[model samples]
Target: MRLKILGFTTLMALLAACGGGNGGTNPPPASNTLSGTVRLGNKASSAQIASSGRLLTSDQEEFVPGEVIVRFKPSLSVQSVSSLSVGGVSLQRVRALGLESTGLYRASTDTAGTLRLVQGLRARGDVLWAQPNFIQRALKTPNDEFYPYQWHYPAINLPQAWDIEDGTSSPVTVAVVDTGVLVQHPDFAGKLLPGYDFITDPRQSNDGDGRDANADDPGDEPGGDSSYHGSHVAGTIAAATNNGTGTAGISWGAKIVPVRVLGVGGGTLADIADGMLWAAGVSVAGIPANPNPAQILNMSLGGKGRCADSPAYQDVINQLLAKGIIVVVAAGNSNEDAANFRPASCSGVITVGATEFQNARARYSNFGPRIDLMAPGGDVQADLNNDNFADGVLSEHRNDAKNDYDYVFYNGTSMAAPHVAGVIALMKSKKPALTGAEALDILRRTAHPLDGTACTGQGPDSHPGSDCGAGLIDAFAALQALDGGGGTNPNPDFTLSLSPNSLVIPPGSSANTTLTVTRSGGFSDSLSLSLKGAPNGVTGSLNPSGNSATLTLNVAASVKPGSYALTLEAAGGGKTKTASLSLAVGTSAAKPTLEGAYVIACFYLGNDCDQIKSRIIQVKGQTSGPYSFGDLAAGDYLLFGWKDLDGDKDVSAGDYLGAYVENGQIALVRPSKSGLNFALEEVQGTGMLLDQVQHALRSLRSR
Candidate 1:
């Protein structure tokens, strides 16, 4: 995705960082041709590209097809693992970094097979999880640059990281899926991979061609010199460090795959999504497959939008996730909620936001729950270093007007994203199996928290995890975490689900499920429903009104003969609930279906056992104790009592903190014959997190 240039201020002084000079006198263009609303819309579109390389289209925001996730019971058996291969089908395993036995799979590219595989897998007693994956995406937010002098690297402790993992020992490549790069730039000398240009619309291509092998910067400015944005991003990722060059990159030994999907007038949803797929070595219909696939994709560009609206883009990202490619996106420079931006808010991405020289959230950097980590994007307005020049991310820039390359300071979440991508490259080099989800877990655990007003507040303001993300990216700590981390999971509500679960529809026929909601914790708040896995010619619609809705699917007569698996995800009440059902084309007895939503919740107790927090779960017919708990929060408890939910410090509705407490053990549960008695009055919890949990529990008690 491309963002029109935002105006920059002048104040060039000494380029101490790069041992260079000149900050320039010219100001950023007085005005931008691309409006904010339209540009944001474009970012959302880029993630889920339509086949047509157009900017606006009705079918751009759909979810990925032919995908599903299944959680198996704990201490898994070989028989269960081997069963992934259905009798007459092939199940491609994506990632397995969730819970102990959770697996993601591309059951079938065809709708029919997808359904059968899911149905068959769920039929197995060992599987424990299934659901839809949601996804969202933005650019460097802007500021002054001095070539080769990047302070952001030090902010994240890159020097220490380099000593531990310079990425030289392994062949690591990161895809810069943006405006393309300048091949001749010395910073990219030995690091450039032969990349592809996915911009099909010649008008946007600006090179008088479409879908060519050339992946060079043709420029994205309307009537000015090229911004060299991709080149800048590449420089940050793997610029030649200690090579006596213009600037040093984060992962010095990593390679760069400069894929171009944006041009003069920005990018389209389809072109960008397709470019990402192609970069990951996934085959696109008309384009040639990428021969040198990358381990990471750094998207320093994006737009504002909800993940739900861009299901198509979400689908592409889920595929990337399955392939274990770490997708890093800029949190955007909107200065608002990153959760509203595409890709950043989308599931499974490492969303990076920018911090200034003072280690505070950048004024323009978007902040919210969606941010995964923070990095130095720089500030051109404040010269805290007394360098006269604004402290911006310094990298390679081409001044076509002067016919020479220039190194300058620039600010934006865009700059921040590359910094993260570079770090991920280093991590991927060490742990070959590092998925985007795992990368985040490590980043969060090791990040240096931005507290003490530097970037700590609540909502619309700065707040760790929720706003500024896990804090400033720490290369050193992250590397340390790589040595220590493993598990990753769902991060959500009135729990909702659909069932009988699987229905078979014949050609030219239809099926329906009545949707229902399960309320808890006074989740009387409004609830809504949406769908993600239906294929073409299959019309899936839902009623927007009323507390209860119906999801009706109509299959056209010309539809292919096959089975389809559908998933329902309920996110609310501080929890994430998901379920799946199968759809097949067969002459099976039909029944009017009620899309039912239900839940069962529990927590593990005992200091020696792994304390699982509230998922508020349960299958319809599961037993109240071990059966409903499944492999979840399973462990030994010395006493019967209530789960503390939060640590003794706070009460928890979901998973943030605490556990079940029994007789003041802080967390435990004592089952009562009269249904079940939840004794919240005596449980002790302290802290803001607990306060919220207490309120939620109170609501549930009254209900």
Candidate 2:
């Protein structure tokens, strides 16, 4: 599943999706007795959110309405920017940041106008790329919960591993990039860092605001079956253990960063990317830098399609990897090729598959070469262990059904991924500077052979999954591989990576990225760096202060025009590491005048014009070219666009349905003339058609 555009289809059942089963057991009595809202499927109501406030069929075309994300060529000047208008519709630039602050603008238009707006923008020469903000779903399988019954930890020898490196000191942060969490749960009290809510849509956030500092779980179910998904995933990684609490986590002292990405309707690809990047301390526009940067990111969410389909995700993931942040993802639960799902299929991530208490691949865990290792992700359908409940991994969650926060059991690659993330926490705690690549290599090298049935293949894929990673993870062995991780003496090693791997620089200009060093084993040595394969007349300089340095490159105006691959090498204490950088030297061609460009309401609204419903505004006016709508009553009115994407307007398919809008809805009134032709009040945003419109378009697209 490669994504050419940085987008995703609406997320489906996450790896931790709840099957139809009464979740086993309920939360034990809490010490506080006052837990707030949060969940993964254990007797759970898996309400994966999509946040699109529309009613469509199972196969709905959902995206933020009245908005389009456009990446303009860097050469285009801000002065050359203009509102693109087509068929009486116009798009106004709402906001821009990231992508090196290259004019990556989110444009806004009126409701029912996304289709026309996207077409207009795509037709322009200056626009490098354009796409609607697509939503992504959480990963986790639904299954019908107690901590004593948690066999997952011992299954991976975590009990012994704890004695070696329990993370009592030098605790690192593991970012849970999933649904929001319940900050008040006793098990998580003092265990959470100040995380952020990256959900940008109010409806999806269910918190009634855009991105903010609050990272608490508001519940994922709009109709009441909310799952505190993020909370569950967090507990598995850092639930307060031996505190007379419910369950024991892999890393008891590790801090959890709750970067909420999934909400009412799961999460958007845009929000997910931002959340992951922010977790690693990358700057996201309109959001503060993360004070508690994570050493690892636990994404128990994903969607179908190739990883390449979403360049945004790939770019962000690369950034995280370059920062030495370990990323762990669920291998999906479709019982098929792990390569078929994203994030898991993406490179540089530790993709984990599920194994039951018996040490065999769980019935639903995806398999294939993409899997880095297997971990205990129980089978919730049957009580193979005779525990009197479902055979699942135990963890704490916000149990709304029990009207309290308590323990529950769930099973999926979602469960498996966190176990690895927790192990990473322990590793990083032992070696504060362990790089992501080093962590993966250690895990794979220390892994044990599969103990599950077949020992070779699982899932419904075509061939035997002999390539399902090295084998089951052995936590104790992994810690031992760290060599004195719990001891004062350790092997000394260091890693280097360059950020913004690719840079586009205009001739005679300069660009800067970052070079970071991660030193392990308490090694303290002076560092020196140099670059290879540089073009003539191009010079680079930086001062290494501590573990980071700013690498600035100046290209002589005489340099040739082309892309150059450069290698950055770092050396310290008789150890060396090499990283790559991409440099492009050229200026984009000038843009031609826009044809039939109709600038809409570009006045007072500014960027906020795209903040809400700028799409398909409602108003009735005279049949004139310029519609100030004189003599029109101030009463609210409905709009009907002449768009039937499928060429057949059918109400059942939600074709051209009047947008469900109110409260000073922006009005798009063409001349009251028989033919519709009027300048819009220029909205500044981007989005796909309403889900209703998308529902019909989906059919047309399939054909």
Candidate 3:
């Protein structure tokens, strides 16, 4: 909501490790060597590689009996070592290698010809990288937990769907691209494989070591305390199952790979981009590959921009998508059009919007044609228990200033994005064969479209049927769709055009428009058309005959002139098509425009004329003014007026400060402006009333 200016220097330092190291005055490539005793599966004799290059056996651990890892010196290649005497017998030829988990002679090589060989072993079946597990500990729910009622459910229903398919057997890896995960949490213990930290503040690490993950520059302070944005997200994805503790994850059997990108304020685009590659198991020249790779990448943070089409960001995203990784991003929180933001706006990534538990769009959730699906982002302020005020939602938060094992409530699209990510993991677990795009298509096709204001129609209206991109997402429907048929067309062909593409009509005015629908196939009788994004004070209706439909609307005089989109849907005969119409409307002729210097005096009046009391005055307005009245506490208000001697309406430049009027009455007779002028105080009793009235007038002028 608020933009914090960040120093570029800090960003550059965080991004330094992202770039592959190049040859120059920098130190030569380090040797890949390990000097330690190797023992067999049983505690038999131990084999050691001494500094003299002789392999000797002792009672400690044995290397020759089983697979053992051996590091070769510089300039030596695995291909040259065709035959080597292990236990006095020449073994098979050794070749350059990839990776082995943790046995003897597991071979992996660096670009400098240094080889790591696992002695007496060969590559076999695929290695399953486990998700980060969470350690569940019970604490009295904190009083500060926001919106506790919404989080009342012990374990959501979707994870149960995963259990039906035995999904936890081979846990899927979900990368939490936020603050680092609490590896020590009871729910996350042993589940967290090795991961990297790109914060560059030199204070954050996978382990609590002073050294960075890459042994490069010191990283930033892992700002874990701000919010458990990552931990909560991880918990939702894979917290560990049947531990008999708190809530269960969508894929309780899966693991989490904590990729710390965001920090104190937030992370940069570069850090996020690099984190994506690392999580997907993409190899970089200098840094060691992720000890654990992810099948699904969850990004719950986003900024405002059309990032989907940007080449700089898309290139990296495309690389991951190509690797069969489902990238889920949060639609922003601005409650504006989501087509204007990055990551979410990108085509390949699954962009998720938020809705309340009541199945309506969250008041603060952003929407647009770009939104692929919606999930429950608790409306903390909603009167879930019939209360008048919003209590907060219960979630994981930064426990303390140090950002450790603390958990609290946090409500945002950040909280909602993980729900969908975890769902995707369950989907993937059920149907491991589904590709990223196929899984996304299934989720969208199966989601139960939310009805009412939550849906953004191509036209203006807050009602259910007038919104956009279907309705609220239905997890049950999504799983069903996955089971029925996995994939569908990512891009479909359909065209919708509207007349009077843009217009500005006064309040209480009406306009007529037509939506033309064209499809690749012939016309059909059964088609459904809906409108979204209607400006305030405007309403629309559609009259469908055949292939064409007429949309009629009247704009209220109070309607603000702005751009709006009209989404038209044509579904029939087992297939559906979507299109949008853009519209604009002007402000009302008699709309109140506040001007000049003023002070507000708020009041509450009872039904009877006899009861009136002063109330708090809060301001909300555009940036052109000094304050915003929108943030004001509730109550009616009056404003005090000041004269504009120069007639400028504003007290600025060379204007003279005129006398303040307590009421409509003032020494100046008949002020020239409409809704201007004050009556003289002939009765003392009316002075208080005049003061309130004058305050209201001043408040209007200030706006």
Candidate 4:
């Protein structure tokens, strides 16, 4: 009566940095880069645009031609400084920065003598700031030996994803619902959470008992050959990364919850179904609730029957989907239509096929409308990396003796499924609340089309060539899709933030922060938390409490000393917001560095809340220098350093000792601000705004 579910190995860019030296038209030199704030006088009017190209906003709003943001001293009006001419230049205000109304303004001028105009403005008595906008680059290279050969990472544009995020800041839990993982594997150290064995039949449960809580693999050997399927799959999803050891995982910061649903002779559909539910933290009859439910579920095992014949499995998939857990499955390796497979053919699961390094579908991979996309599944016969090693997917496996951890090459729809699963984990790590439907959509929409144009055909169904799903899954493009093009959300519904926004730690030390996600504009759906951009030797952990999470950052003694940009994101209800922080390692009090800060203000525009700008500040102990906020949209605003002094992400009464604020709310006429140098003051009042900030800070402390 048990339907045995067998394992199926399913078959399957850096932009130039701004440089200087060439000419006004020549690209900036790759090495000579600049980083500073640009300030304007009046908000640039439409007619004030230069004679050449009119000002246009790039994604960062810093690429507008003939314009730089302007910040005026507190209590100063745009009109007061509007008449102060520099050379033949004139100034006009565009808008405020975020919600701030008075201090900051976007200014425009004729393109001629642009550099000279900036110099002239800086010297003026009325203008407080003028500088060129600086460009930042993403980390493109990892020093790992096999990284260059990981055509999979670059093929999917993971370097670009790395620029945006790495899994370190907000670690997401991914359930590897397969044979069982090698808990003692070095690559999986500290990465495995408590898991359960769902195999009810003692005969197939090779570990001696039936339906136990131990999820460690005892080595699945059907005919004297141990298949380290789970270990390999788990490694692909979260192998110890950037450790100068083995290959890196797509989402290296993710944690794996190994739920053993299959054993020696494989497992039945019933056990697999229960395992899937349990992986999502759903209650099973006799098993304890999974304390660390997975945000993403990877199922590389399936039956060879159409989903229509497996109502039970299909229902579990739907339930997992409804719970906001992304389900990723392998397209059956039978070289037939995936619609003939159990979980792969089921609705609501992302069915992935295998692709070789040549971008062609693997010879044994299934193909059909049901297949969602493809990923590097490796082809053992070829050495695509040309390193003299087989191109099979390299991951943590077992030695022939089955007693120690080793590396092995594997290829199948089973292998391809984990790549997609790992990518989904990466997406979830960046936007934790991404729904199953949304995850599926992003995979399909952002996949590199493998329409058989790039290489010769392969796969059993390959006639004209390879005919798989959309194409190779692109990690970078998929992550970009999560940002919804990195502009204003037309339906601004939720607001999320991380306290402390910046921190400093010594080598071998650790730090902590808090993240808060608040529903707004009528948002009610649940949201998920994720962290991105931690450097090597640093790991981020998230313990969630309702809409808030406490994030802890741990650094290894050997972590290289440098400043890292980190992001905290919350995604749900089909929308997302990201807050950033700066972590400087091996830094000292005497050598302080101004990481970054933010200010909130209200406006008269579309939403009552105008803009939230990242305010630039000096290092903690700096005595005096003008702080500037550029390209601010017009509105009334309040400023708070929001320094999580204790790293608790809260504004306690004692923590407010050095609170900084302007005399009162400033009304901005343009998108820049300067002067009105404010000093730290003791708590002056306890109003609704203060209460709100305190309330947000307390969310992280609540649990």
Q: Which candidate leads in lDDT? A: 2
Better of 1 and 4 by TM-score: 1
Per-candidate TM-score against the hidden true structure:
0.52, 0.58, 0.48, 0.48
Cα lDDT tens digits for candidate 3, 532-615: 666566788888766578887777667665546656666765676665554545454433222332222232221111112221
Candidate 3: where are CA atoms >4 Å away? 1-143, 146-163, 203-211, 214-225, 383-394, 401-406, 456-468, 485-703
User: RMSD of each candidate?
Assistant: 25.9, 19.5, 27.1, 28.0
TM-score of 3: 0.48
The alpha-carbon deviation from the true structure for residue 162 of candidate 4, after best TM-score superposition, in angstroms, is 1.6
lDDT per residue (tens digit) for residues 291-364 in model 4: 99898888887755556533456556777877888888888666777776667788888888888878788777
Q: TM-score of model 4 relative to the true fold?
A: 0.48
Q: Model 1, poorest ten-residue lDDT window?
A: 33-42
Q: Residues 438-458, candidate 2: write the lDDT tens digits.
A: 788777666765533444333
Query: In model 2, where do residues sit more than 4 Å from their true spots?
Result: 1-67, 76-89, 102-125, 144-146, 451-463, 484-703
Clashes of each: 73, 66, 108, 57
**Candidate 4: which stretches are off by over 4 Å?**
1-149, 222-224, 453-456, 463-466, 486-703
Cα misplacement distance, residue 699 of candidate 4 (Å): 68
C-alpha positional error of residue 480 in candidate 1 after TM-score superposition, expressed in Å:
2.6
Error of 4 at 40 (Å): 83
